[model samples]
Target chain A: MAEKRKIDARGSFCPGPLMELIAGIKAANVGDELEVLSTDRGSAADIPEWIKKVGHELLTTTEENGVWHITVRKTK
Target chain B: MKIVIVGGGMGGTILGNNLARRLHHELRTGKVRITMLSASDRHMYQPGLLYVAVGSMMPDELYRDQAGLLEPGIVFHVDPVENFMLDKRQVKTKSGAVHDYDVLVIATGSRAVMDSIPGLAENAETFYTEESAVRMLKRLRGFQGGRVVITVGVPHKCPMAPLEITFMLHDFFKERGIGDKVQLHYTYPIGRVHSLENVAKWAAPEFDRLGITYETLFNMKEVDGKTKTLTSEEGSSCKFDLLIAIPAHKGMEVVEKNGLGQNGWIPTNRTRLNMEGQENVFVLGDTTNLPISKAGSTAHFEAEALGENIAAMVKVGSPVRDYDGKVFCFIEAGKDRATYAMFNYTTPPDPKAPTRAVHWFKVAYNKLYWASARGLL
Candidate 1:
């Protein structure tokens, strides 16, 4: 809740944003929230599925000003 | 006078065959002799090894005896080379025998630079050599399940190999019912997934369907054996239980030691396979540091032009042909679906512009090229 992390993955293609998100989550502590900014259209759909399948907590996925922002939390 | 060619590779064998066929009258009259030096009696179809590794081609199909492939007038030397005496125009073998030549063709192709990367010697395995590819096939077959990472390292011979292996791994895992458990990661040093932009158009869609994570523009720096993670230049890393790596490739050390270049790759004119500064010494295939793809098809095209040029140089003392740097690579996209692209360097057509028809054209090309190279065409 206290620790918040952010990863900007704009201008990257598919799986690039997801990979950055995963790496960010791995380094973040449990209960820490990580936000990912991506420009790829696939990232908005891919990041949530990855978070759900891997047992991570997806706080929210939103699009603002032509960029998709995905927030995830380390569950375990 | 005798022409001695070292290494029975694409460049060497192709040059030897074309010369022997073209100069049949001279050879019959005993005016000239052609001798090809090779250590092993086997002649391998290097490109076929990729299909062989992925279970699409069998091992026996990729290999043929040296004698069976060479032209009749070309003599074969089944011995490793000791050294080349450039000034004396002769080559010495390990058996204390010296062979002289009027013209020398050092077509010794490259070997995999396996030791260039950290942990490759101890942790990672490669498909660079025929022997190693066979080992990799066995390693791929025995895998029940685990994290799979297919990486294309620096200075690799064929750039499309990692992508092919990635698709093959996807199919391999799906058939074994362990596709879900196996974490697949594809990595490359180029900006796009494929070096050519045209091919990337098709590749981008393929990766999307397979859910295969591809990391581009990341140079593989090192492998941590303790953690099983391969680190890249941009601080990105992937952990893998099974690591099949394509290491850096370098030309034969014999050429490198003679001051060809840093990695044994000689700088050659893109339009002609001839060495930049040296006369009478031409380089082709994976040996030369040409600004083209190191696929067999490119070599086949180069050999055709160089073969004619060599004939012209002998008869008229001038080259009549030049290499166009054209390359067409067939990318296997699993389940018999493939896509290919054709383009040339030094031109402004743009790269990676793949046509949907490239997929079928590539299949026909593979068959056509092999038959032609084997003299069946």
Candidate 2:
């Protein structure tokens, strides 16, 4: 099983959360799962698009308590 | 009634979206037709450029399709306006098409005139447009920990941007472990660091806390790009490793070409937002020579009153609404904290100290702004 890392980018703006997710993915091992929590609603839409563009596998996305949680898995 | 709006910038788009939604009935009945003329199809959320400069945001995220933001009843034209024939109530486009209008809204906004100061165009990095912001980001990433000077040119839009960059650079350098090696300086042409007295008072100590040298009333006269030095009109000189300047701004070229501007900016009635001596024409945002900060919040506030006034003008043939020159600015102190100031023509801004809550609000506002462009917020 791949290791899971969490990045709490809540209260951060657009691209803030996305940038944090990218940095987190860079530090994680291949096949590791990374989750980003963001309060900026645009992240829900932006992160998924970015993950697809970068050739990463998106696991799931959910919203709870006005915050969005986006999870991705590093494929390479 | 034909309403023609020039310049699909923040002010023009907001006014057009509001007016279109408010006049949907008249538009459906063919009693009103709205046309928007924009130089390009891109609508930029300018506030996001600050984050782009700091590498927190991407440049592509700051832009949206201009045509997508308008309602179905409005016509979006991607053509540069060549001339404004105000006397004949017509606007001429670069394609040689003349658009006649019963009501004209001029929101052409301002443009950065880097050539105003010698050597500035070749030397400094500005965070105003997407291309400029990307260039600034590249320059910032390659900085090697020396003096970074940020100057606020006179009558520049978003007066707080230089301050925000100052604070963000402090955090950025610290994060890079070069905070002790880098020195930050902020200079403005005004008598104080900020035009609002209370805001200046509140910011002075914060600048000191951040170890930023704040120089006021220092008007830029020349820049030597080869030597990497800047000279003030008073003969004072400063050397810098990198120059980040809020370049000199002026009203759009079409406005000046048509002789509709005084001192390079359109003069408007401060309260009515109408062009001087032209009752059927209106001006808003940075294009107006109003004694107010040319920030996005100013455009947002002006849109509120202008929308009401335009609605009344279309419905009853006269405007009854008045503007109070309200402006709100969220000042980012660092990556985690921000402060806000709210004021109007009669009241000076009493700025609060930095707080995490305001930072979150500013973050959320960036997302909410898209909804606002679609006339949903």
For each of the candidates, the C-alpha root-mean-square deviation to the true structure, in angstroms, is 12.1, 20.8
lDDT string for model 2 (A13-73, tens) is 2114664565356446889999888766667876787676557899999999988989999
lDDT of all predictions: 0.71, 0.81
True contacts kept of each: 0.00, 0.00
* Tens digits of per-residue lDDT for model 1, B204-272: 787888898878755567888899989875567888898888776667787767776646767776676
Weakest 10 consecutive residues of candidate 2 chain B by summed lDDT: B188-197
**Top candidate when judged by lDDT against the true structure:** 2
- Candidate 2: fraction of native contacts reproduced: 0.00
What is the C-alpha RMSD, rounded to one decimal, of candidate 1?
A: 12.1
Error of 1 at B113 (Å): 2.3
Deviation of model 2 at B61, angstroms: 0.5
lDDT of 2 by residue, B195-262 (tens): 55577787878889888997765667789988999987545789988889987677787787789974
Q: Score the docking of each candidate (DockQ).
A: 0.02, 0.01
TM-score of chain A of each: 0.91, 0.92
Q: B184 in model 2: Cα distance from truth in Å?
A: 0.7
